[model samples]
Target: MTEAVSRRTPGTPCWVSLIVHGLSATQDFYGALFGWEFKPGPEQLGPYVRGRLQGEEIAGIGQLPPDRHLPIAWTTYLATDDADATAETIRSCGGTVAVGPLDAGPAGRLAIASDPNGAVFGIWQAARHAGTHLWGAPGTPVWNELITRETSSVAKFYQAVFGYEAQAVVSADFDYQTLHLDGRPVAALHGVGHALPRDRGPHWMTYFEVEDTDVAAARVVELGGHILQPPREGTSGRLATVSDPEGAAFTIVRSGER
Candidate 1:
């Protein structure tokens, strides 16, 4: 199993969390699916819970505030050193700061923001917690991407906010690009040339690697989750789109198919 020994690099997809109303049900769902062990997070961090794999931090879950009106979904966080500066930059870059430039106790500052096309993500400047501690295996998050039709504006907005150099990948089937930080690929932007049906809006798509995509997809359905896309083989592996009972969508990928 691969493990991360240090903090994630700035501007990379550094962390993820499920902001759900039903914390207990959400905890049980993910725990059974990913084989995660949930532990009470630091008390100063409010109702946040850290999800682990073999005792290594993998992801998190937090109770959604009743005062805030937002959908239940997995929020992806991009690493930053200055959340307040980043929030201001997000506004200046034509994006919106939907939530905070607020303290997350000693875990560092956090700010929720959305790109020009409404793809929501978080800015994290970790203090005591440096994001995911394990990766590159079953049940570990491996990639994050934004799905949108507004490729140019979205790409320009992120580059302005994060100082990323987005390089387009030439493909006959679709329009896609990769965000680079110091020449290393960090994330991707995929243009489907159409809005997502069901008013899903433009959103960040997080991928969690699994031992078997087909099996996971089936289990997701059996667990009362909905299958958005059936399992299919790709160059990298078999993948599928699925959503929790409350309609928070995510993807699963089984690696090394080819």
Candidate 2:
């Protein structure tokens, strides 16, 4: 029951959203897996739906436009005071704006951008909606990370855009680091070390906390989703990466409780 009662700092991972091919099926799949409750946004919001836990907003799901063949993927958004300004920074830092700094009626202004490494994310300036209201526990998001082969350039690019400092983690086999702003861990940047299909490209990965990793991973498979990684034990407990039937990828972790 970790509820975010106030605004997050600028550059924080403020929101995560999914744009999927089938809206209804995505709703049912998450609802049954996480016990989430979904509320459709105003009519003008089209197929937008807000997913919640204990009445606090946790994430969003929207229907993919019929004419677009865009991959079903979850987006991670960073908090900003001005979305337009942030988009400018993205461009100045050698990134590209993939979408608008458009208004979501009362939800605020937002734009999607891809980093120099081609990891796509969003910038959000909160209006009536201040992004996720709850996090850091089971059934809520706990971590966000970007995996790319161009670690040095990506580090410079993000620091230029968001004032982030990448601190290397103590691992010999994995070239990974956490991004921090004002000494608070906001997200992560990891070097893709092993053989992942080249077509996957560099991308941001969203991780959700679950009560039980085995159960959750099994449930994902049961509900027409595919398990990208089998459950594995680590210092952080059991975790796995999975994709919905529509092909959006995300990870689930049970935290330190085994």
Candidate 3:
């Protein structure tokens, strides 16, 4: 069991959000799958709510922008001390800051950006709300990783913007590297080359912790979601890639469950 946290180390993934068209239906899917309760929050955003588990905030779900056709996917937010500076640094690092370093009421400041490889993520300067409150438990985020065409350049971009120390994990056949901050493994990068999903492109994939990956995948299917990958043994545990009813992709892992 891991302790609940109100704050996280800067440069590490602090929050994840999903924007979809049907808020009520999406909420129902995740709530039934992960046992999440919803609460309206950061009202500054048009239609948004925070998903909580046993009173601790787990993630966020909001209505998609009515004007644009944004892909339905989870966006990982990295903790930062200064959103303005981080947004500038992202621009200088050859990344694009598509949204604001603006305030989300008193909750925090935020900016949406994408790496050179076009993997979108967020920079969060937390205030009263310090991102996700609990982790390492069932229904909470356990890992955030970048899946791109190549790791060399995008890794450098993240390192320059967030000061992540890149350590090559598998360089022979697979180009994988772990991103560390203050000597702690915070995130990772995987270069899958031509295998990158044409519809999805490069993106940050969020992995949530569960008690049983197989059961969770089954539950997702029951809730009108789809399993992109069947339960498989991963380095840390059993995991499966799944998408919600709205088509937001995320991974679920059951640690130490062989």
Backbone-clash count (model 1): 0
Please report, in order, the local distance difference test score of every candidate based on alpha carbons.
0.85, 0.86, 0.90
TM-score of 2: 0.95
Once model 2 is optimally superposed onto the true structure by TM-score, how far is the C-alpha of residue 128 displaced, in angstroms?
1.4
Q: Between which residue pairs do clashes occur in model 1?
A: none
Error of 2 at 158 (Å): 1.1
Q: lDDT value for candidate 2?
A: 0.86
Writing each residue's lDDT as its tens digit, candidate 1 over 1-258 gives 654455666798888988887778888888888898999876655687889998888888888777866777788999998899989999998999988898888777889998887888999998987888777878999889898885777898888888899999787877888999988988999888755654678889999999999999998988879899999987567899999887889999998741
* lDDT of model 3 at position 138: 91
Candidate 2 regions exceeding 4 Å error are 1-4, 42-45, 170-172
Model 3 TM: 0.96
lDDT of 2 by residue, 88-156 (tens): 999988999999988889878889999986789999899888888887767788888897884767888
Candidate 1 vs candidate 3: which has greater TM-score? 3
What does the lDDT come to for candidate 1? 0.85
Q: For model 3, what is the C-alpha lDDT against the true structure?
A: 0.90
Task: Report residue 19 deviation for candidate 1 (angstroms).
Answer: 0.9
* lDDT by residue (tens digit), candidate 3, 113-135: 98877889998998888888787
Q: Name the regions of candidate 1 deviating beyond 4 angstroms.
A: 1-7, 66-69
Given candidate 1, what's the lDDT at residue 226?
Answer: 89
Q: Which parts of model 3 are misplaced by more than 4 Å?
A: 1-7
Q: How does each model score on TM-score?
A: 0.94, 0.95, 0.96
